[model samples]
Target: MKLNVYADKMSQPSRAVVFFCKVNGIDYEEIKVHIPKGQHLTPEFEGILFFFLFDEAINLMQKLPAIADGRFKLFESHAILIYLACAFPGVADHWYPADVFKRSKIHSVLDWHHSNLRRGAAPYVFNTTIAPILGRPLNPQAAAEAEIILSSSLSKLESFWLKGNGRFLLGGNQPSIADLSLVCELMQLEVLDEKDRTRLLGPHKKVQQWIENTRNATNPHFDEVHRVIMLAKERQQHQRLKAAKNEGGSNMKKPLVSRM
Candidate 1:
């Protein structure tokens, strides 16, 4: 039986899953779930939708980017990556090496990511970009706090994880599941204005290089999966320009105040 994958490319974890499948030649059917449209909440999607955890909130049923292979079912991006790497005999070893110590380091990076890198990056992007798109008020204070955390996370990622001459995390020459996971999370910032995105990521040159390396390594697949985000960014730019034009026209229409 073929592997069935339900996901939305716009989602970080979902993109990670898609990249893994594409890079590894894993044959799977892609099922797109439009989360923003409330499609995931529908009864038909209850079991296949992936839900992101916010604060203390958790929904046990939401599972997106999920896989169903014959009788087996799996959720969680890290687990799915590891499972694909291990389950397929022809997959490259570097993805999740058989060497115990190297594998342990990869695992460590994955675990630390949830609480540190992802914690900082995901919230920062969503709060600043997604919330506003959904008609929610922007929270400057919260976004600022998340930015500080994200900056610290990037620093650690550069100094500690991608230290020395390594192109990927944990000093690995090849990209690992950890690299894909964190990179996708950071990719969420593409929705921001170019200046803001550059300002947030510019200080960390290593991170930037790593992103390029990962993209090069993954090639067309990575770019293909990220097309959704690129489209969204373009739409955002169009909206901003239209809004500014409307405001300018309104201002011109207002009569000037004459001095008495």
Candidate 2:
């Protein structure tokens, strides 16, 4: 069977997976999972995981961005990426290179990304931007706290990882999987109002440049994959505008009833 990549583009990791697959000319079919419709939890997803015997950590979660290669099933974007890097022929060496120490270093950055950058960015973006679009109240307090963590994470990446000579992470001229994953994660911030987004990212100038560098390196594929995110941002902006207009209309005073 051909490789099957199950993904929802709205998901950061999912976008990373799809981007990698597309950019590398890997032959795979992308099965779209409409996450907002709760399709990820459907019986169809569970049906494919009949052989769910991978380690507990990688056990199929019936989540977006999983892959099925023959009888083998895998979840977790990082695991899938590593698997793809090794399993497929014609993948570029720079992505998950043959050099063991470099591969380990990339893994180190990915590990930190899950716990730090993703942790902070996901909830922070949700609270400040996505929550309201989903009909949940935006939580300013949570966003504020999340910003502190995200800012710290940015500082760490800028200071520790990207502080050296490379245009990409870990001093590499070409991007690695870590670079793609982290940049995709940061794409969620595009949903924020310009002022808010700029304020948050403003301090980390190097990180900003790194992002552009990654985008440029990936070129057409990167922008094409991220069109989903850009569309999402547009939809959210429209929703906000409509909501504001409706609120204003409701606030306008009606003519008084004289007989009351």
Model number with the top lDDT: 2
Q: lDDT tens digits, residues 51-78, model 1?
A: 3212221123565667766556778889
Flag clash pairs in model 1: 49-63, 49-64, 50-63, 50-64
In order, how many clashes per candidate? 4, 0
Please write out the lDDT profile of model 2 over residues 214-240, one tens digit for every residue. Answer: 999998999999999999889878887
What is the Cα-based TM-score of model 2? 0.88
Q: Which pairs of residues have clashing backbones in candidate 2?
A: none
lDDT of 2: 0.87
TM-score versus the correct structure, for each prediction: 0.89, 0.88
Candidate 1 segments exceeding 4 Å error: 47-60, 251-260
Worst 10 residues of 1 by lDDT: 50-59
